[model samples]
Target: MLDREPYADLPDLPRFDLTSEDVTDGGPLARAQLSGIMGAGGDDVSPQLSWSGAPEGTKSYVVTVFDPDAPTPSGFWHWCLSNIPAGVTSLERGAASDPPAGAVRHRNDGGTDEYIGAAPPPGHGTHRYIVCVTAVDVEELEVGPDDSPATVNFQLFFHGLGRALLTGTHEEQ
Candidate 1:
């Protein structure tokens, strides 16, 4: 297993609260959180997420799902949603299908503008999914819907005011 913390190189931003109803930190992902699109024999549903205690000046939020233990140098981005209204803190399960108004769903590594759940290769051991919420200083990032997750991350590096994260693990035979 790769010992990688995806955010290790990021600036030490203030931390906040992030919780999920369908995914538990350090626990195995539910079948709903696995990838049907990738033929993982499970529904590719995004988990329900909630957060609080963001920095005082936070104007918007960004949400991302990353797989750091992927078999590639750049890892993989499963989801990237940006420009979420600051007042909005919780996302209902399956919200990836219809993101909050004004929020932009950036392209994931799979080239889809929605959450594509875990589908690590069989026999690849376990993989960790880091679900993150970022409090941003600006109302909207410079990137557009066509932009990649890396682009959103780059903007986040500059305008992010706080961050919260939860992790879930999964594997196949």
Candidate 2:
């Protein structure tokens, strides 16, 4: 038996499938997109992401990338976006940084409203980037455009109907 909270009162939230061609599980990120500018530091662009099989009642979508292995005990958020139209299924490179109209981009832990590529410490081994696409019941959350990732998450907790997650790992060179 699972010790997690019961969801008997909530709608049956089904799991969706998501994938990304620009990233591989337990693999290294492309050198061109590594954290730290080439010869400086940071990645050049965000990874590509795609998904399918959202629940029938899904009215919108929310995308987020999290790094649990960050130095901070609570972890770090790399990117967050909400209000993606249900018809849309994927995001191209750099989309997280400059999302299309109707979508809202929240500030990451770095205090920037853009995707921050992985930057684990020199000997932290592999760090996972949990990329998620949440099927939401609401077309748009009540959050402001300048809200932070934490605020977005609070809204998501109440609005998410289902979610799909894909994990990619990166290590310092």
> Each candidate: how many clashes?
0, 5
RMSD of 1: 0.7
Give the whole-model CA lDDT for all candidates, comma-separated: 0.93, 0.75
Q: Over the stretch 30-123, how does candidate 1's per-residue lDDT look in tens digits?
A: 9999999998887889999999999999999999999998899989899999999999999999989899999999888888898999999999
* Candidate 1 structure lDDT: 0.93
Query: On a 0 to 1 TM-score scale, where does candidate 1 land against the true structure?
Result: 0.98
Q: Where is model 1 poorest over a 10-residue stretch in terms of lDDT?
A: 1-10
> Which segments of model 2 are wrong by more than 4 Å?
1-13, 37-42
Number of the top-ranking candidate, with lDDT as the measure: 1
